[model samples]
Target: MDQQTIINSLPLHLRPFVKQQRYDDYTPRDQAVWRFVMKHLSRQLADSAHPIYKEGLERTGIALDHIPSIDEMNACLARLGWRAVVVDGFIPPAIFMEFQALKVLVIAVDMRSVDQIFYTPAPDILHESAGHAPFIVDIDYAEFLQRFGEIGMKAIASHADLEQYEAIRELSILKGCPQSSRQEIETAEEKLAKLCNTEQAPSEAALLTRLHWWTVEYGLVGDCEDYRIFGAGLLSSLGESQHCMDDTAVRKLPLTVDAVMSPYDITREQPQLFVTKSCKHLSQVLEEFAASMCFYRGGTESLRTAIAAQSVCSACYDSGVQVSGVFTEVLCDAVGNATYLRTTGPTQLAYRDREMLGHGVAHHADGFGSPIGHLKDFSRCLSEYTIDELKAHAIEIGQPTKLEYLSGITVEGTLQEVFRQDHRNLILSFSDCGVTDLHGRVLFAPEWGTYDLAVGSAICSVYGGVADKESLQLFKPTPRTSTLRVDVDPSLMACYSLVDRLRQQPAGLDADDGSIEDALLAALAQYPNEWLLRVEMLAVADSNLQQRLLEELRQLGTANKATEQLVAMALGDFPAPHEDRPASA
Candidate 1:
């Protein structure tokens, strides 16, 4: 089957979600992510992975230069009687199984942002194209996958199963969202916890999917003592793939249908995995599974009995530790923004555990899963101390402590505290590493002279090294806090800084300098998504600079959605409507 044929075969409801893999749609960042993950994982997986995985990759012609085109991949898959198609992100388990049954692979269209370089909760090109697709070329393995899918589709699941699908999707988006605050992610996790602990038992389909997840997604192959990577989940992950092989603590058990059907959490690392004797043994196990599967023999009632006996899977919590007045805990997961279990109460010093994952916390409440939203800027309240006070505190704590500044730069310091007086904020601190901007550019090193960085502006490090940290044209303060903590990209920050500075200067035309706007235009070349941020910056600029920014926006043309929205905003005249701006743009 070809791309269109595969789409046509899918249920009409699912067809709209399937899209052509527009190879040109990928950006430089996407390419870089693909290259970085592959470069690191290739050597690690070479000896550890099933031999066919590397061979499939070579035959498919995926390389470091760019993302593979689906058409090209299908041409290779055709030889093995398989085809590949791209999906928006994650699909329903039934739809996913249907694709597998039809000998079609579903690749996620979006690539994870750099912030989630290690692992993304969502399936990406790395997991789909690079991980699962490579193994499809092994004819016997492919046949086993197809048969499993065929059997899987017969399993019945309730509507409640879909809740987890939405929860995970929302969690992935929130993690990658630059604007999402720490509190927001925690709240989302709490909601997910409630859904996971629902009174209803998991359906037959959900049970089968769990089995598929453990084996095909995160499974290992060989004896319990020794194993190789065959699962797509490990094969795609740079961290877990290596960790699974190197960590002796990770339990590897002999493959069995019962072990594979056991419940597992998507959030945390696997404490135990089922390992098969060989690739062919996988088929043998599936054959045995089919004979006993509820889908074929026992039906939904038996699957419900199994689900009722299974324990609820909850996210693991970070080891509790208190630094000064701040108490922090992280909800452990395989990847993405970890939810923090924080408190500002009296500190209790405990031995912090090294490996925090897999030790499941209580499902209902208390400890890690206790009600969230109690702590707010737990570290910010103690910012009142002077440099001397901070140094004393650091010695008392016995650590290389640091403090965050209102200016968005974090400095190496000791016992510092916060004071509030009207609107303006101040911090008294000392530093040995000196003060560095949000972009990691050293603004004040001991040997290096003090330098002020603006958007699109350049500076030399203490070692005299130069890189691409440009001064921005804007500075939009986040709603949750006073003083910018600067979580946004520097390019956007530079654009924000530009317009902010201009707004402070003069509103109308200024003859002082056009270089500021010129510099902004140059910076915008690489980061086109900075267009909306630039638009916000333009509102603060003088009339001349605003016009110049508009002209630059026009010059950018409608190359992509970001530029297209920018051009539309420019043409719409001054004061672009906020609601009209595309979220992606």
Candidate 2:
């Protein structure tokens, strides 16, 4: 399947986030970066990573030599029951999860700069494709990833979380760009720091992201003492992959629902990693955590979470009716079960995820309020009462009716309408109504206009977001900010292009061509400080020139410990070294 066909198949709402991969946008240097990262990451992870990783890379459509194209990848992904779509860096987590739930991988379009070659702060194409898509070949891991999306998308998030998402997204984009100034980064950091302190408590979505960060992003697999690399954050990263292996610096713990309790810092290396017993164990731990979320655990327990979010949420009553709005208050009974709930803004009444007729945000534009317990003498729910039975009891429409609740609340009004669905009363509207507690504190007065009391016996469930998704766009995913492009000198680009030409040769080309060798030597002379060029040149250079390139690399490595480590690692494990290092370090 082609990218366009796969994209056309997506939900209309998600297609806006999908972008075209301008394969032409990648420069020769960019391809070199991809090759370098994949080459070393693969060799380093051969034994350390999950065994399927190498096979997965092949099964999925990633190539070791250059950046993988979407067309080839989508074709390969389709065979594994998945598809790939390119997105701009760092889409909203909920949106990302939604795509995953649909079994479509959200591949970020931006490639990391060579400057941040080890690891980039943003969700670049390298991380999204090389880090994530490789594991899609494994059925168990794929199912776990898809299931995570299904649950995570429903997780309730606070309005403040939206602000934080934009902040973090901005920081990642700026930091990933080589040309971004230190002052600009500091400003973004300050804003993100302020948002961090603003969160009084982690919302359901916030907590779920912790689990995702720990597992999908940076998780390990197997026992704490003996684990393999499965996390994309580790697999795509060269530095963290090695840093995490040091037992003294990075602690390893058994995977559990408790991982959610410890939040992660995306810009910094994690201090700890969670290890699952197996891929199946990942889903088990996920279920354990999910079972505790508001969407799964309903009633007053869930309502409080929604109320605290201070954003659009929904509460399902025992009568099967759901009210969605920015929840403000929840009156409780002696045992703390919700007795009466009130929403202070536009609220919609929905049943089975569909809006109820005559009751929507427009009708209740001001707000909504209703009781949520059984009637004083009723052995069953008020909604369950028959129309004839209600009329016999003097609660008929168009007549004066008064009712008492078990919670010491009373309703007196001229019943104007009884809204029923499948013979079950969903709402009872009244004119000239007066609702009050035993203490005579009026909940609703006659002057307030018609009162539409939701006819439910009790609160059954409460979760985040509107029950009817089509009701309102309460939250929008933060769209991606463009990654910056730092221009390189033409001569330097020419040199990179020449190296790329050598790399793509049917049979490995030696630097025996005088003009090619002169250009290589001129590049080495003009950009003497560059080490990656030397590394790239070392691969295609014959024995005679390899000695000269190795000498240059050694000199470059000596200036800094980082370069030293890179050259040492790249030369030792780069898989294309044609010459042996000198006996002297």
Candidate 3:
């Protein structure tokens, strides 16, 4: 099933939190804002953000030009044993933690406008994808996050805190709505400010949330005297990210339970930020906070820390949290999707396999793995096909794809050609056709009709057969104009080709006719502004190819705005900030 259809079919309980990244929802202005942020921050963040932050950006497939696709992100993240899911703005703290506990990164799909680009009052795509998604690439950091989520889920908040969460959610939803007026937004922001500025002390849940904000949201990394931003809040906002680093007025302190327990303001620039020495330090601080929790103090020891010490059977070389460099013998079912109890020394192992009945082994029929910790190969599934099989499954050549317009009119042809106009709108050429549709319901009187060919409506094939909704091809309509001009990124063509190839069968990394990558790279070199497309294709290339592309990008140097941003993003070292770069919004 297509992604949108699959999302629509999901049960109501999960639907709101897990939605599709409707890439088409983004408008031209949104794309412009994304590029603006990428161009500026890619250069501005050179000396400020943690090294892993940029690596995470590359690893997770987040690019500069367009809003990221969560499915594509998950494809890359899956290699690191993680996945990305789209959420509708801010979810409950506990729910957010629950998602992380499952090793799933929750991303907000909405993008901020150019006006609100510098600092979005609530969670948006910039904050989630650009700020948070990249850091998950580091195993230690990923494990630390999962553990934080596990702990945060149990850290119950007070009624007052819940009210604050609801208020924040309402404001975020309002801001994300393109139709929301300035007055309505101001009204919401006013109410949120009052809630944030309240003088009352925060509850345990609120304090824990504060900790999350200081660390995950606005926290810094490195020694107390010298640090860089790893926090999403700092990473996503151009104004704050730069101000926090440049302005000596902002106080920096080591990350600690006490430090985060203090209150903070959301409406204006923060006067202070806490820095952590490393992810391990954050983990230690988290455990310290967990130990002090009212729930833990009430005599219920967290199962997370216990399994590590009491359950070892000795002489094992398996998976799970590593303690004293010993493997914790994690088992799994026929497929690797379900991880069993008592796995590696890795902390994520505990939260990942929390349903064990005894000795970290699940009671289900998957059966407990022997304590011998022998490595099992579950790389390919029983029904999976090889690369050779995938190549054989490619769609037959010379078969022209069919696209249906308004009314009974049909356009049968292949993608005649595709290219970017100055690296902005993706231009696709279809075989010319004489106007038909005498009835004129689909396209008549020069009206505007936008349709997603894949799932929006029924289209017929060359054999006069109705197209299946499961098909991935989408037929988007251009505005009411003489020439067909659609405002989509040109990189989408290569993306469509890659997805089509993958759906047919798993292919090799450098496996296509090379036309798709060739077209993408040609566009990339021609349009320096197409950095996101470069990042997207680079993420798909095999390791060796990615390195080669990096070298090619480096060779370009600080030639232009696009190439400079491309080289900086492709390999985290950007040339000295060009005075010509976009000024902070």
Candidate 4:
């Protein structure tokens, strides 16, 4: 029969049951058993089962007041051109498929006492009717089931080896398995089944079954709005239905074929629900599967992007960079402000002394004899640099100079180890690293500079961005107390470790002392004044223990200062301090 025609012929009231009903004659015990099963499972469904299950109860004319007889259900099915059949217990896959292909629901004649609720192997009347019936009424759902059954039977008949495929797919959909593990099990089963019959491997059909379950059986409705329950498992399970809708952690992601086959835990309520816009959408998915556009392996790009972004971003900010105290100092006789340089090339440009000299020629007299001299003067003229001036400098000098500022800081190796041990006590001090607050607009630096720090502020706004708020709260500087042990969150700490590891790599990407100082200043902007004081104290501790620590901090601060000075000089903020000094003097 044509799919839509079958759908059209279905009785309006019984349409919902078409997907759920199994045909079987009820003996006296069967009726009693149905009543007994319904009575107990009803309690579970009432509180947590999908709303559809309750609707099924009302729509299918199955009364909660008494056990429903098979004859009565068959009459309802017959009205919809469907029927119910009875099986002793477990039926062969082919027979089950045949029943479904004929638009007949198969109900197994078995009973589970109230005590045995926890364990029942085969589908008893309670499970067959109550657990799965309501969804059968939905035309799309019923069609999918019929198709699934037909496909399943064909595969079974074609190949004996496919039984394991059927079993594993059933187990996976009914139960969730991790993807790798599921694949392994499916592979083994397929190989074993193949030994028997290669013509029809159950693996392919089994995958479709899983897809059907994910989309048609346990699928959810709606997007960010109200989600209606539709899947038969959810429709049947009282507790799961309630839990899925109410749980905050139970995210409803857009459904895709991969997500259905993806591992999940069925014993527990799903932590995530696969949501479809409508039943038609699900039907379309099956149609695609029938056409063979959807494959069993390979995932979508969006999924990969989500995984990568989440993995990298999840690491704590503390792990990426450390900040200390801020120091504002004036330079005496520096020749020129340090120029801000940005890398505009497609590939990353390496910044070395020679490169700095080449870029510094137009701005600094006699090229760059000492980058430090330029850096100090740059810090003194911080007020003069404009955004444009900084950008121009960065474009010419390249991004490497930014790394130069961080050079000599022991951010790698032993220093990192020391900081790790006593992160609370160690202060990451900042000097006038060429970064300017710009009224919270941008974090401007000369020689690889000018970033959208305003966006940083917005992200770090206590009221917004998760990353910003979390970083600020965790790293906010505070006075050291005996009980105060500053420990970076594990994720952030990992970032810091990554940075350190990257620095050690041959490329030499370590943040120079100046860049480090600038980064600290940027970080500190998110916190209160007290946090600055705490940072200063920590810096002092490091200064006392390691001479390199202070020098590096000074360099970082100086580099920042130079970048700003260069920008200021370029923008005509003030005369370059050393330009006026006698060349001989």
What C-alpha RMSD separates each model from the true structure?
30.0, 3.5, 27.7, 39.9
lDDT of 3 by residue, 1-585 (tens): 245654564433444457667787766446656866886788889888898877889899789756777777777887888777776667767667767887878887777754466667667787888988898888898899999887776564544565667777777666655566799789877887787676655555677788888998898999778898999888988778888985477888888878755777787899989989999999988899887763454211222222232322111111211111122333222333112223233111111122111212221112122111111232322113333332343312233444333323443344343322222212223333222232432221112221111111110100000012111111112122111122445465545345334334455355555775575556556655444444444545666556655655665545554356435644663233345768789
Write candidate 1's Cα lDDT for 1-585 as tens digits. Answer: 467876776655456557777775665445555655686678778899988888889776566446788887878888878877887666666667767888878888777755565668677887887888887877788898998877765454444565666666666667656577899789878877887887776666676777787789988987877778899999988778877875575778788878645788777778888887876888888777666544344322332332332311111112121111122332222342222222223211111211112211211012221111111233322323344554555522334455443334544533232222222112122234365544665545645322111110011110000011011101121223211111435564455556545545655325455776566556566666445445555555666556666765665555555346325634565643256756775
Q: Order of all candidates by lDDT, from best down to worst?
A: 2, 1, 3, 4
Question: Which of the numbered candidates is closest to the native, going by highest TM-score?
Answer: 2
Candidate 2 achieves a global lDDT of 0.85
Taking all chains together, each candidate's TM-score versus the true structure is 0.52, 0.90, 0.51, 0.37
How well is each residue in 372-453 modelled by candidate 4, as lDDT tens digits?
A: 1122224422113444554444411223223122111111111111111111211111222344321332233334322211
Off by over 4 Å in 1: 1-6, 9-13, 298-585
Please give the distance, in angstroms, between residue 180's alpha carbon in candidate 1 and its true position after superposition: 3.1
Candidate 2 positional error at 146, Å: 2.1
How accurate locally is residue 392 in candidate 3, as Cα lDDT from 0 to 100? 49
Once model 3 is optimally superposed onto the true structure by TM-score, how far is the C-alpha of residue 287 displaced, in angstroms?
0.9
